[model samples]
Target: MQIKLIAIGKTDNSNLITLIEDYTKRLSFYIKFDFEIIPDIKNVKHLSEAQQKDKEGELILAKTQTSDILILLDENGKQMDSVAFSSYLQKHMNSGIKTLIFVIGGPYGFSNALYNRANGKLGLSKMTFSHQMVRLFFIEQLYRGFTILRNEPYHHR
Candidate 1:
């Protein structure tokens, strides 16, 4: 299965972008992984938190396809260890899904439609993080998970 990361905004920091690229490249060795950045909504400063989420949610939904499995990288969702995370990927790959899209929602979080559209949710940690930073963290973890799955030296218990 191809794994894609769909995030709401761009990563302005050069350092973060470099790290994200590094992990993203490493991930390509194990699976077809791509990070797609959805452009930030216009005039978001004038909108309320709910409105911003709704607008971002529309962009998120637009990027998804009917056959894709949508998984939200949310804070309140289930948190699993590295080993279990690898097994989770194994299970999905075995299920024969065409594409698996993991979303990093906007700062205000997801809308009702996004929540309903998602098939599952997985949390990285309880601590709050910027959307840009979460992109790097999640991608790195994904690379690590695949390395662990292959019994490679990239990941150590």
Candidate 2:
């Protein structure tokens, strides 16, 4: 199955981009992986919180096909260990999912519409993280998940 990570805005920090690229490259060997960045809304301060998320949600929803399973990266979402995450991925692959679309929402969070569309939500940690930093974390976890699946040395039990 193809795995797509759809996030808003580019990572301005060159160092973070390099790390994200490194993990993304590693993940490609295990599964079809696409990391897409939706441009940040211009002059966002003028828009209300819900307004920004509503507009961003439209763009996020547009990226997915009907067959895609949308997963949100949310603080209040389910949390899993590395091994469990690998199994979760394996189960989805076994089910023949066309595409697994995981989303990292905007700074203000997701709109009600986006929340309604999501099939599931995953929490990396209870601690809050910067949206840019979450991109790196998610990519790295994805790489680690694949490594665990392959019994690679990258993730130690």
Candidate 3:
């Protein structure tokens, strides 16, 4: 299955972008991975938090197909180690899924509609992180998960 990461905004930090690109290149060896950045909503300052989430949710859902497995990177979601995450990835691949889509929502988080539509959720850590930083962290973890699955030296238990 193809793995896709859909995030709300672009990364302004060159360092983060460089690192993300490195992982993306490495991931291509093991799987078809795509990273999509949905542009942030305009005039968001005037909208309430819920309104922003609704708009962002629309953009997020638009990128997905009915057959895609939608997973959200949410703070309250299930947290698993690298090996377990690899197993989760394996399960989805084994299920004959067309695409495994993971999303990083906007600053305020996902909307009720988005949450309802998700197949599952994952939490990277108990600590809060900037959305940009989360992009790097999640991509690195995804690459690490693949390496572990292949018994590569990149990830050490």
Please report the candidate that would top TM-score against the real structure. Answer: 3
Q: How do the residues 1-157 of candidate 3 rate in per-residue lDDT, one tens digit apiece?
A: 8999999989999999999999999989999999999999999989999999999999999999999999999999999999999999999999999999999999999999999999999999999999999999999999999999999999877
Candidate 1 minimal-lDDT segment of 10 residues: 148-157
TM-score: model 3 vs. ground truth: 0.99
Question: Model 2 RMSD to the real structure?
Answer: 0.7
Stretches of candidate 1 off by over 4 Å are none
lDDT of 2 by residue, 27-108 (tens): 8899899999999999988999999999999999999988899999999999999899999999999998899999999998
Per-residue CA lDDT of model 1 for 38-89, tens digit only, reads 9999898899999999999999999899999999999999999888999999
lDDT of 2: 0.94
- Model 3 residue runs over 4 Å out of place are none
RMSD of each: 0.8, 0.7, 0.6
- Whichever of 1 and 2 has more lDDT, that candidate is 2
Between prediction 2 and prediction 3, the one with superior lDDT is 3
